[model samples]
Target: MSITPQAQISAQDKSYSAKALVSIALAWAFDAMDFSILTFVLVDIMKDYGVPLTLAAAVSSATTFARLGGGFLGGLIGDSWGRKAGLVISIIWFTIFEFLTGFSIGFTLLFLVRILYGIGMGAMYANGTPMLMEMMPAKWRGFASGLMQSGFSFGYIFAAIIYRVWYGDLGWHAMFYIACIPALVVAIYIWAQVPESSRWRKEKSASKSHSVPVSHLFKDGNTWNTIHAALISLIAFGVTYPINIFYATLLKQHGHFSPAIVANTIIILNVAGIIGNILGGYLSDIIGRRAVLIISAIGTLACSFVFQSISTDWERNLFTFLIGLFSIGGVWAAIPTYIAEHFKTTVRSTGQGTTYHFGAAVGGAIIPLIVSGIAPSVGGLAHAMTYSVAITSILVIVLAVLWRESKGSVLE
Candidate 1:
């Protein structure tokens, strides 16, 4: 049972991969916090700026639309330069804008800063995810993917806490200012501790050209994979945005819940979401990615129905937790790993960024606008969101069934 030198190196790499995961997840959590803090305070922004619901929704949508460009640029930078470089730059870029969001003197300025912030947000995922996937041991990829995605939920919880503590007295601007500090720390940690992806380095050394052409994404029968991935991402974003963006507002204005109740309920939702993310990732590893996705989609649909139908305060809390678990948590856990496996190492970041952000632009951006616009006619925001979730969940189940499974895919 003597361990060979190669075996020893493999063991060391696995150890380093776990460390890298923490650093990346920290960056992801802060990114999520910065993005989600705005949602919790959307109504406050509207009151201060004297904008309509649709206009407030537009600010969120504008950020998502900008992410489309940011994602593309991040992927290109990742593939051309290095994952670390792409990630660090994206983090710094977003941190600056998120800090500036507090300084916005008017609705127009807030909108513009958020749009700029969206690019950095988009880029972080494009760069950080591929790096983690490449570094993680094959056996742990599913769990790692789930944990990484859970950072977003963790961030939402962070946002909720900050909102509850600071929004009433200090105002929304202080929350944004507070977010900048930890994010900068995460950026520094990643730069210092997280090593470049070995797979990316190997690819760079072997390739003649430093950059992979984006055109390659459409060639070699990959166009279908590209289209399918984008459609899946679009569906995920479409279902998610309507609910995540509006749920806080719904609790306050529609349900007439007090601020504490709204914030506490959101915290509960994300806690369940965090559990779902980890469970979904673990299940995907054992059962297969498509099966987990299908299960999550169906579960999400069922939970949304219960969540909408429930009447009592405790019942609402119970079902809201379920909605977060299945819809927000479970469905997203497998996405990064599933999407990353669709492309070769050379084009992985670009493919992921382009497809994910395309979905963000079309599904994430447009669906919120539609929901906000139709809320009055559809009976209310809850009705509109429920309908959107039902339709999109069906799409997710279909797409998961049709999509080729990428489990146990070895990175190039």
Candidate 2:
């Protein structure tokens, strides 16, 4: 049957459910935690497994490259099979590899395992963001999207807690092990608790009667959707990726900080991010997604400069917090929700996931190589970051201006 009349909105669309939002948010948090956990423990893994800093970074980059593929595959699965299927499989798939990475004997084994984990992660974002966005009321789409994206901050904070309590004594393997518990728990929760995307199921059945899938997105006015979302994803992470991924590395190498200081700095950055996620999410509801992007781009550009200037512990803590808040916490408030607006339900996850993960691959995996490669000649990572932020922020603003604002628009 079609969407019930009383519950129907924006034509036949149904109101967003809190249950779906919470389920997707929890799953997204574990995905974020999975990614963040590795970032915190990478240095120790390098020392333990006998690899140089460059190789270790390459291992991380490899996972990102793999994710580009994973995201596309997962998006297809999500759109074709069901969001719940992709959701459960991706969570369990990644967590298993994450647990096994702890037992790896060499860089090759670790690299292969992480590549598989990246695949799972790529799928997670593809499935999770669209799954949640498709279910929400247009009025609360920004709020719902931010709630799902904010899981990254929660995951980062949890990873920091692991580093604070266990990194000194238990080491990198234990950090990977800690991630397994949550992964298993959440995977079970998702299968047992979360419902499939009613929207996808309804549309899928409708289209099958015609035997040809909806072809509107690939042509006409919507042609640039996939490209636009991907570019937006790339720019969002332009500063966010390098800043968070290299937080520990930058503080230790550039600022000459001890391990204790680095851990504290990470925690502070994520704490500020949690607040910014909420603030930006609500503001997008009030102001609009484009405004949130402009505000975030400007904030990230300005804060990145301050972030590069850190020397003292106070400087590191304060600036790290600001960078996290502005670069990701704010931009994330609207990005996934905004991207969801670019496509109808059938291709929503596909468009959002493909571009977003490709962006992640570039931002998370590729950009660091450029910065680190130039670090020796450029004075340090700080100067490289300053230049990157200036350039990326302008690009992000340009995209935000050009991309239509989708605030309060109903999902099709």
Candidate 3:
């Protein structure tokens, strides 16, 4: 039987149940927790292994590379096995590795485990975003996307608080051990709760009747648009993630803030991000996605300069909160929903996952290498961030000019 458009949407509204959102949120929250758990504990890990800071950063880079690979593979798996099942398997895989991460003895072993964990993480985020996006009503897409993305902040805060409590004497191993708990719980929740993406399931059946799989997303007209979107995401993160990671260290080094104060500031940033994400999602739903992006890009660029210049903690906190708010609407929540708009349901997950994770790999891995490689000769972290943010801002303007609005337009 052919699926009516109304019936398809109605089915999605009912099937995407609160249980499903909760499952996706839990998985993503765990994903964020696992990610930040390591960041909080990285110093101890470095001290224990006697590795250089640059080398320690490589572990994160390796995981990012692994996640990219996982995202590509997860698209196929989501197409074949189903989004719900793919999510379950990915969470389980990541959980197992996280459990084992506590036992790792050296940088090599830790890097090896993280690379494996990245595969699962890559698939989870890739599949999770599209799954949640497709399952919701068009009107609520931005809201759902923002709420889902906010899980990262929730996880980061949870990890920070947990680390503070546990890391006092138990050290970094306890943090990794703690990481295993949430993923395990999410794996079970996803297996038992989340429903398969009805859209993907319908498309897969349609493709079987045709005997030819859908073409890869890169071959489409929106392909160029998708590329631009991916580049913007990469450039956005070139500042976002790295800034979150390095800012505390820089404050301690040059701003004369103590480590405790620096840690509190980092937590505040994550908390502010949670608020920003909700506002961004709500605004995109009320205004249009394009409007949200334009506003976000301008705000992020302005905030970057102000954030870099502030020396006092109160000034820094106020600016950081605004920066987090700008980021919430534009870069973080809008990108996945924007990518989802560019392709048909058949290729929606593929386009969204690939561009998002590839951007992540670039932002997480390449940008850091560029900054660090130049840091010795270029003076210091603050100056490097200033230059990077300036370049990224121009790229955002160029990308905005390249993209035509996709909101309220039908996807294939």
Task: List clash counts for every candidate, in order.
Answer: 0, 0, 0
Q: What lDDT tens digits, residue by residue, belong to model 1 across residues 1-412?
A: 9999999999889777987789888888999999999888888888999988999888889999999999999999999999999999999999999999999999989999999999999999899999999998777898889999999889989999999988899988999999888889988988887789999999999999975779988998889889998999999998788877888888888778888988988888889889999999998898888988888889889877643653587788888888889888888889989988888899999999999999999999999999889888988888888889999999999999899988898876
Supply the global lDDT for candidate 3. Answer: 0.73
Error of 2 at 199 (Å): 1.2
Worst 10 residues of 3 by lDDT: 208-217
TM-score of each: 0.97, 0.92, 0.90
Q: Residue by residue across 25-132, what tens digits does model 2's lDDT show?
A: 877777777778777766777788777666777877888888888888888888888888988888888888889878877878889999999999888888888888
State each model's C-alpha RMSD to the native: 1.4, 3.5, 3.7
* Candidate 1 regions with alpha-carbon error over 4 angstroms: 1-4, 306-311
Candidate 2 local lDDT, residue 74:
86
Off by over 4 Å in 3: 1-15, 209-215, 220-222, 252-259, 305-311
